[model samples]
Target chain A: MSAPVSGGDRLSAVRAGMAADGIDALVLRPSPDFRFLGGRGDGFLVVTMDGAAETADPRPYLPPGVRRVGVDPEMRVRELFGLAVDAELVPAAQVLAPLRLRKEPYEVAMVERAALAADSVLACAPELSWFGATERAMATRLRVLALEAGCEEVLSVRVTAGPGTAAPGSAPSDRVINPGDALLVSLSARWDGYCAEVARVFAVAEPPEDYDAVYSVVVAARHAGMAAARPGVPAAAVAAAVAQAVDDSGYGRFAAPGAGRGVGLGSDEGPRLRADDDTPLEAGMVLCLEPAIYVPDLFGARVADIVACTESGPRPLTTAPSSLPVLER
Target chain B: MSAPVSGGDRLSAVRAGMAADGIDALVLRPSPDFRFLGGRGDGFLVVTMDGAAETADPRPYLPPGVRRVGVDPEMRVRELFGLAVDAELVPAAQVLAPLRLRKEPYEVAMVERAALAADSVLACAPELSWFGATERAMATRLRVLALEAGCEEVLSVRVTAGPGTAAPGSAPSDRVINPGDALLVSLSARWDGYCAEVARVFAVAEPPEDYDAVYSVVVAARHAGMAAARPGVPAAAVAAAVAQAVDDSGYGRFAAPGAGRGVGLGSDEGPRLRADDDTPLEAGMVLCLEPAIYVPDLFGARVADIVACTESGPRPLTTAPSSLPVLER
Candidate 1:
């Protein structure tokens, strides 16, 4: 098991980022950002952009220089608000976002672990037979797999089978898989407070004769997008590459212009791969490239992989095979 | 199966609320509020103060809407920012509190179902004494129970046992339940997109002599607070009653003054039960009354129940017996 990183180490990174960004202080709401910096605080935090800091004794576990804001008088119990007086208190809504958007080394590591776990779960998809298995059952299996893989939580598991199998962002229904129906399984796992997401498509009975054609198009698009990932590259180029591939394959209508976006502490992280997004890809950033083509009311296919931008190029963190649809008996 | 409420019925409620609150328009983020308003946008909704609304078709469901804006060019794609053309896509952060704080009848019903599921999970707590049962195992059992009881999802299950078990908001650890350790199980279940939370303290072996005294104090405090749960009562009075009971029992340190808060579609709903809060209790509101006392490094006891405020008094939604701690072999 990986040893837990100390609160001090995590706070230092935040301080460094604040200095680099010219931010005077950082305020984090009661979301994952607060938990990422502070070891424990149910409320919110206002981290002064100063150098090293420390919480007083008795509340030793709280983040340094962090203050716990009272819960919104309308929202939280007043007595609970004064639980930690050692740290400064502030309103949660006042916390800004730009400072919390970037990921730190430890946070990145956790995201990578969650991504690997998602990949592992997708690799085990063949074991989830289509027959007699409900969408919810498949989802439950995926969740169990994620937890066993050291993920603290499973954010979501959306499985759709047959013609009605919807696209990503859709909730799973009780639909049972049948022969020749397409199965799309999208899952996100959280490890150490970071999120990793991946999706896999399966051909229930036998692979369609044209399955390779569709799969090849998606894989090519994913590869094109991944290859284009590097520091200073425009986010839209990555999205356009995937969209162009789908359009070239005569599936433009089904292809979502942007394949996917960044994956980190949250299921949907920052810096989206879209036609209009101009944010440049930065080293140490992680993203998921999911190129999808949907034939409405008929079938849909998506191939997603978690990739991390490194000094050299984008490295695929999810090693699960994405060549062709797995035909399960 | 409960029939899904119609869009017209939901719209009518919004219209009525708008007239009463004198709100010109309500911008809803793509969270539960959007769903509660009978629209499945990409987590974004524009409701005119006049009650006319337009929302993006939920990607997979693609419900009808007047105009749709794709993902924003500048914002990160994963973030819940809706692009709308015809409607002013105002930032939803401003109106979320007001729209969600007040509960509608349909929302109350959904919350009631969620609370019922939580009660059902608590009912099965006694059966978790199987040999070699791990915290994860018990948590999974609770989740399964909630799912089987028709909960679409489980918000969270926080189970802390052994020496560090008394504190509220403690995350679940991997420690096995040994003899004489206190097991604190707090769970929040979600049904039809509404959340309800409850907690209970369990003694793995024979309880200490002071257990009954402390337990009775909490129970009486809970009853006292419940009696004050009328439409016009202040939120702080409820908390003060619980605190007074603990102080009267000579266990003031263990008494968490603000142990209860509003419970509804969200786990931490509005109108907190704290000594400083002055928000008046409303008849349609549902709240969780959790009175807990923790002696550091020793043991803690908490008894939580879901209560719905009425014009007459507070109606206890959780029927699980809280007379004494369950002593397990």
Candidate 2:
């Protein structure tokens, strides 16, 4: 689903952000900012009072005497811009993140489409169990489904299935599924230029009591967080809601990290739903509300869904069968 | 193939790099440096004379240091590390690239295994053409093959097919193959912790003469670059040698941007073979030498192989049949 991007509107929004920071020029890479500004190629975009121009590298061609703001804090990018060692460089995020945090109609549609693709991939989880497939193989199939569902990029497709539990951030390995194990499939899909992420937990058979306990707490936290995602509320309120549910279950320690995050051009966007941040919620922002818990080497379970914040409430963009069937062979 | 990592050796190398830069403490993220320093985490890493510690955020945990150096010049990371706004954070690559550039024996084996996995997948390319699979479907199968071979991670597997040519950096899309269209499958697979990359071209039917011409030039450059690899040689020497061959063919301009990169714990690593970089080659270092040419909006062809440097010369780690017959219906 492609939208005809109007260059002037997107450029104006960026200029507004730059003006807020008292800057005159914005240098952008092939990030969502560049796409929003009507870039079709995978190159650098220089937006200044002189107007927007696409260039191979912006450093050599930056118009003289323009106060520039940019992203990607890598020294190499700094070198490309010929930024002197002491020259003050403003982060483009300061200018673009606000513009990006508010989703345009096209971005909302793309995020919704991304959620649909992720849900469609999980629809085949039962068959995945039937194949008695390895985690890596199942992950590969998800990649195909994600692409077919209109995902322009699959940043990561994580499938954790097998006997023992892997730590939260570990990559999928050559682990085979067993009868009483759980499956955790997480897909980070990009549609057009926006991003959407969804995660689900599956059971091959009746899982252990520990798994069932963790799943119950996780699902409760997920619901609580989604319920708190209303306009005019604080993002930390969402995190607190989820945390309260997990703590009430006496598994509070396991919920220290990975509560959830905003979903957009960057998978990990602004307004991270953590215990300490108080970024305000706004209408038209997309988010992946995830509540996860890990029992170290025993087992882990979590569920995530893409939700869009509107004036009415938090509307989930994707649907999973509310009652997950016991996926026994 | 896994290696028993003695934390002492890795720490020593990192410490030595810091000493060369006259810094006592090194702050690292979940990069190759973190892994080399015996971290099994995907988070921030801090190593000092006092010892090493892993934290969710390095900023809070960074001790009132003796002396500190770091890479990520990004404001966020700098803020996390608690460096002053004007703090001179050393580029981590400058310190770590030299260490990562020299592959330990186990690291070399992992790189070799990654290359083998990629080549093994391509060996079935003829079968893939017989199935007349779409590029998206072929990419999924390649992912499975890669993991089955030895890849603990599929960093990126890009498959470009159908009509017009896309730049080297474009993501794989859901386009079906046509009778005369060409397929370019590029993979970056991670084994153990090391990375290896390989790419090959396939034709559904007899391709146009122009496609064949670009393919000839690309393959010649690939061969020339691989032959130029040897201990004690400068990386720029390799790039220059490859450029000469491509220019001689009169199709050099089409080879802009991506000419391939180093393969290690990260898909793109150090000792970059470019005309200006003068990093010296050392034995045990692994590389992916790719020479490509693209005729915009028409077609493109390129071949990449993983090669290792040795005292004698370059050792090819991936074996595509000396002649890759066009995959046809």
Candidate 3:
């Protein structure tokens, strides 16, 4: 379901932004900004007043005696030093981040496609043999499922089981799944250059004592966040809503750092669902609303799904499970 | 064959190098430098004169009145601007690259394990069904094999077939692998935080016209590169030797840029095999010697293998095929 991208339109918008920012030039390496500007490969993209050029080196294409140049946020310090250019350097995000924050129709479609792919993998999790399988093995199985689901790239596959779920952001290990254990499976993938993430918590055979209660609170928090996502709303409000739900449930201390952030060309971008970020959500903004709770050394529950802000309301991309899935023993 | 790494020794060495370079502190994100120093997660590592500290926010760890701070080469400019530090910024590679060039005994073992995993995947290529298979399908298969072989991460899996091979650095696509097509398969993987790469070329059913002639030249160039890698030899000499072999074979124009590069914590690192790099090859330095020739509109041949430079000579880490293997139709 790869849609045709209008690179010309994006380039024009970026150039217009550059003019407004009074940026003389942009030197980008292989990054989200470079890709959005229609450049590929591990090379340099030099955007000047005249036009843009992709090259192995940016020095020659850079405007002679350029006053101010915007550099890619992803550009390495080694490459930054190697530029050997004399100019005031600024983050290219000044000109590109705003343009990137709001996804166009095609970009949204790509993200939806990626979300569907990730959703399909999670949907098939119940059919897989989870009992006696190590977390690493299950992670590998999920990765294979992602590739089979036509993911252009599998960014990350996380499988945390039993007590492993208590540790946030834990990589899959060789710990075997046992009966009545809590399991968390998350997959972030790219489909046709757009990125999306989906995560679901599960139980083996039966839910561990108290896991369902925590899991329900997590689900309620996710709903609160999504309900708060609307055009013209401050992104922080969505974060606050999620936090409020967890706090009302008396699990305030167990809440994760913040609600999920925006997802598109980059997994984590602008309009972050955090208390500190006040970027107003606009129509066409896609956010991954994930609210999680980790009861240290016991269990944790996290559910992530993508949604697009619209005039009417938030439209869900990846289908979040209505309740925790219980796998066969 | 995961070996225990003594991170303390490496940290002390980096500190000494920082002192020599007049760097008051180093702030590294999640990159090769950070991994080498034993920091985990997507946090910042601040190495000051007092000690090293890992935290989500690096602002608090900065030594008071820091003058010159070194940053990770792989750090993004966006993060750089976020630092808001009042000091001259420099690439940390100035102090880290020189020290990272030479691998310790445990690092070598980790690299060797990664190399073997990649090699095992390529070794099984001939036995797999290739007739009429799409390049993307083959790539997926290789990815699965890499994961099954215990790769912690699969960096890249390239499958170029027929005329597709003529285009260098082409991502796997839906093009069918016809009989008599030349195929190039490469896999780079990480094992226990160390990285290595292996690639091999194959003839499907039978060899394409002039393919063997080009393939042999590529093999000879790989040999030339490995043979020239020894203690006290300049990295440029290895590139020169590889170029000489292909040039002497009358396919000079088809030769790829450079010979190969150092492989360890990062798949692509320092002591690059290029005419511009003058770093000497030390006994413990590991390199991936890849040589290729892409004949326009016909086919291409690329063979990559990892080798560890030793006092005696070059020790092969990943075994390069002795001859081109032809697959069944």
Q: Per-prediction count of colliding residue pairs?
A: 7, 2, 1
- Superposed Cα RMSD, model 2: 5.4
Using TM-score as the measure, name the better of candidate 1 and candidate 3.
Answer: 3
Q: Which candidate is the best by lDDT?
A: 3
Candidate 2 docks with a DockQ of 0.15
Model with the higher TM-score, candidate 2 or 3: 3
Docking class of 2: incorrect
TM-score on 0 to 1 scale for chain A of candidate 1: 0.77
Per-residue CA lDDT of candidate 3, range A180-214, in tens? Answer: 89999999999988999999999999999999899
Error of 3 at B211 (Å): 2.3
Among these predictions, the greatest TM-score belongs to 3
Model 2 score (lDDT): 0.71
Checking candidate 2 for backbone clashes, the offending pairs are A70-A92, B59-B80
Residues B158-203 of candidate 2: C-alpha lDDT, one tens digit per residue: 7887554446666666677777776687888777777788888766
Over the stretch A286-327, how does candidate 2's per-residue lDDT look in tens digits?
888888888877777778888888889999897444544458
